[model samples]
Target: MAGNDQAACADGPDFGPLAIEARGLVKRFDGVTAVDGVDLTVPRGAVYGILGPNGAGKTTTLRMLLGIIDPDRGYRRILGADRPHDVAHAIGYLPEERGLYPAMKAVDAIAFVGALRGLPLKEGRRRGRELLEQHGLGYAADRQIRQLSKGMAQQVQILGTLVHKPRLVIFDEPFSGLDALNQGKLERMMHGLAQDGTTVIFSTHVIAHAERLCDEVAIIAGGKVPFAGPVDVARDRIPAQVRLETRAQDGPWRAALPADARHEGSFWFFSLPDTGIEPLLRALIEGEAGILSLSIERAGLHDAFVAIAGEAAARALEQEKPEELRR
Candidate 1:
């Protein structure tokens, strides 16, 4: 409801303060650059998302950020601390792969991890109870971890991440096994956390999930970032597509559009042009076909992702050695 005080998480880099600056991050594996030079900054109480296709180096980046691995070259300042993982006591991290102990009771497993993150066993269990109740999983706390469904397990992992009251939360593929409703629940929880001033960073393969949940996003492909900005601003990277929905039998704008643009039923499609489709639409109005609706369709985050991915692919192809392409 309140968007202005969006700095809810980084009130001063103390309680889950701003922890989103990574500079010139470079990671290499076996003489191959997994993450090329890249710089990113996220504020406190901000929902920052990292997105890319499989094998696009997203996991490597997250691993480095979590301190499970370190960058060969780079620097990061998180939560006012130079080392993010060392401050695990205040940072909650949920890896993409589920790591819950199958035989342990869900509640006990959660508390155990909280304890590892620095909570006393008693307080860990107590806080675990509160988190379960808060996230609507109180009834299932006593069940064995393996007995829980995939969605339930995911919720448990998320609960565990936050059990220790970490200020900065990192989630990799948080929506992995969720149906729409469950995903929505997780999204709501994420929003609630940000509202309470927790700097939340997540990595996802799906553009839509990141688009909906993040205040800002970084789209990385082929170890390069082609787009890193606000969601609405990213949409403008691709020229806005012009859509026309009408019953007119003879739409004059059809031939002017790119060959890839299609006409289906009452809808005529056209990609954003250099000068935009404005002059063309004005021409249509002058011709008098009785316009129904003529507006620029907002490009989705997926569209922007695809646009950058295509560019990366092209660049990679150009940079690929002749021997590599032959193989």
Candidate 2:
């Protein structure tokens, strides 16, 4: 039955101009909807992030896309194949649950994982050793997984995921167990992969990582996507903010300030007026408002997430718990 499905996916219509496409994807478990009408479009060679709080259906959505679980309604294509596992050879996936044989040596575990993905044992071992050495894990290559620290073991699994040199890589909550140094290393590795033209997708509640690493992102909340597009586009949904420090708090120019503007000490904060800053600046100068300092800054991914997904979802991100518990 699986073989027949693979054949059908192989012969299915090509999904043009996108690395991943999904329309109205829906999934449910035990009569409870976990994902609802989620859609995504990921371009080739881009680093895309699925950004959401815990239990917001990120894992379920990823599973549906990867064919690990089927959606109740809707369709998806990965690497132009109608079924994701049909092109399994071209993809690498790192699940949230981390596991490796404790008795196996680090390099052997990596090689073993590659072998499951159809890489020959001999060549996989060679690549595994090379990967370990390149990533500064050469000294631990011969050490058993049980001998390594949790972070080191996780690093071995990450290398194993890449040993086969896949075209599309998906990582679910890949940063959970790593220390700050390992997290920095992983960020660099992701950048290197994107530079080599690989498509990278990851799910995370960490807005900082998505802001720094993702070219595009989808913001999911309450099992629905509120926004999905280039990172810049999401941030641009809110206008730039203005911070003005003036020596004079009371002047004719005060009327030019936004009605909702607030001040702390000498600084005033408000959104950039739709009329633009030029008019405001002219008014300030003419009224001798004594502008001391001025800065206009666009909203960041965190602020954008709050605005798009709501405060409830933002709180969920801050107080992250196991997804199962939330569900």
Candidate 3:
């Protein structure tokens, strides 16, 4: 049973080596080429993120890796195992599109999913209840899932995915339909799982969470990966920039830096090709411009994402131009 092997990750890193690896991964649906030659690598026990705009093939890529859909080309490995289907016992997935047994009680819903994964019936029920209560949905154990709020229902789905205690977890837009409160809860849950040695890979269009939650990130667009690196390393590579909010007077910072600095209201922001910012900062202290605040601004995943996904999102938008024009 899949559940019998579900806790297999507890003994060691799945199959060891790379937790997830894909080279020249390609997939097509209806001949549109949803995923094209994408490559990815994820370390064991790390929180990895994939950022992309809609239709950038993030979902399709995940589907292929999870063995739900077959990629037309390329190769992938999970926990050193080439067969994703065979490794299903160690993986849990939450898709952007949700499916639940609405008529079933919340506890029963989660248990049902665990049962399919080969979880023992008694343990499945126990885990279902524990996860529900831990997520603050305990009181709704006997309540029908359809009667819960959208956010509560979303939680039920998330619980279902992890009920069997899989070693690798994948979330597709896990934060899409929730308020700030619930999003925070999910974030905490993810962190907790990672601390327990679960390897996690999730995709999102939002950059802030990826910046905070992931050790490394990959930005994909046009069915390809344009950037993949450690968050700090990626920030350092994109050019060092600075933001200063000071009095609008003739400050030395304005005079000492390169001439290309931009003024946004009273704030001056500029990027330096070189990292030697000491000279400029020293000049600012000497001038006494009453510097309200100074902050180093590095290029973030959002910037790289925009630089990469911009073209793809635009193409998707353009494809809908005719329908939009009709409106």
Model 1 stretches with alpha carbons more than 4 Å out: 1-18, 245-289, 311-327
Candidates by lDDT, descending order: 2, 3, 1
2 or 3, which is superior by lDDT? 2
lDDT of 3 at 260: 71
Q: Which candidate comes out best when scored by TM-score?
A: 2
As a whole number from 0 to 100, the lDDT of residue 114 in candidate 1 is 82
Q: Best by lDDT, which number? A: 2
For 1-327, candidate 3 gives per-residue lDDT tens digits of: 012223334333436646899999998877788888988999877889987777788899999889888789999988777888777867889999988878999888888887777777678778788777666678998899889999898988888888888889999999878777888888877777777778889998667778889999887878888778787776665676788777647854557766678888878888863647777777777887767887886787655555655765635534533342335
How much is the lDDT of residue 291 in candidate 2? 94
> Model 3 scores what on Cα lDDT?
0.78
Worst 10 residues of 2 by lDDT: 1-10
lDDT for predicted candidate 2 compared with the true structure = 0.87
Candidate 1 global TM-score: 0.80
User: How far is 251's C-alpha from truth in model 1 (Å)?
Assistant: 12
Candidates' C-alpha lDDT: 0.75, 0.87, 0.78
